[model samples]
Target: MDEIIQEDKKVFLYLNNLGDPSFDQLWMLISSTWIWVPLYIIFLYFLYKNYQLRSLVFILIFLALGATVSDQLANVFKYGVARLRPCHDPSLEHYMRIVKCGGQYGFYSAHASNTFFLASYLGILLKKKIKWFPYAIFVWAIVVSYSRIYLGVHFPIDVLVGAFAGSLLGVIFSVLAQKVINKQKITP
Candidate 1:
């Protein structure tokens, strides 16, 4: 465990150090949830385009629930693991570039979890309707997840675990939502 943690720190440092001051603001913006509102709106538009009003409402409910689950699950892991964010780690202070700092714990990033959750959820929901969308949204999730490392707020392992958990939650929720849709005979 200790050796793996040490490797995590080393990898974190390598990724965090790749940042340049010139791109700090861009990464910080990318890290901000508010900055992605337009993209989220676009996602909503796509959802509306694909599903009927009733089905869309149900899908939206599942989306909200999945995102909440992903975020809360991350919180549980963060507090349970009690791992320190790179920005808040004393040993990493000297070696890392702190473009932005978040809370004390960042074992698994909520941002990564939530974004990946949305990506996986929407990607599944919209895959058939928009053939190219799944790939694009996954890329978006990856970039958003990477922004946490670039900003020195999370380790690579943190983001990786969050992405995995979020993806799993997404698949679960999407399956459940699809069942509801199928049972209701809600045609898109």
Candidate 2:
């Protein structure tokens, strides 16, 4: 286990050293919540305007719940694992410009997790009207995950695990939320 981890770290370092400043700048710009938040709100507004009120309510609730759960889970992993961010890790070779060394652990990226959860939740909700929703979600997920790497904060595996974990959490929460709503309808 230790050997495998060490090898993975070596790979992460190698990849981190290949960063391009231009890509890093682009990643930083796109990953900003200032841009994505308005976009998210616009999407929700469109859904509310075009879809049934009940559906809009349910989807918005589920999306909020999914985001909260995903964020907490990522935080738990970060504190529990207590791994150092690549920018802070002396063992890793750094080449990219460091915006800031985030929390102590880089085992899983919070940005990746949160964006992935949002993407998955929205994709599921909008699956019917937009055939391309899933693809767009995937593109966003990849970009958000890669931004951590480009910023010299997270390792590739960290981003990958975060994406997987967040997606799973989003799906689970959506199903759970739907079930709860169904039960409430049946009872009252």
TM-score of each: 0.98, 0.86
lDDT per residue for candidate 2 within 37-110, as digits (tens), equals: 77777777756665566655676788787888888888899889988888887766454457546776887888
User: Worst lDDT window (10 residues) for model 1?
Assistant: 27-36
Backbone clash pairs for candidate 2 read none
Instruction: Report the number of the highest-TM-score candidate.
Output: 1
The per-residue C-alpha lDDT of model 2 at residue 79 equals 85
Q: Candidate 1 at residue 32, lDDT? A: 93
Q: What lDDT score is found at residue 30 in candidate 2?
A: 71
Q: For residue 181, give model 2's deviation from the true position in Å.
A: 4.8
Score each candidate by Cα lDDT.
0.93, 0.75
Q: Write the per-residue lDDT of candidate 1 for residues 60-79, one digit (tens) a residue.
A: 99998998899999999999
**Clash statistics: count for each candidate:** 0, 0
Flag regions of model 2 displaced more than 4 Å. Answer: 93-99, 180-188
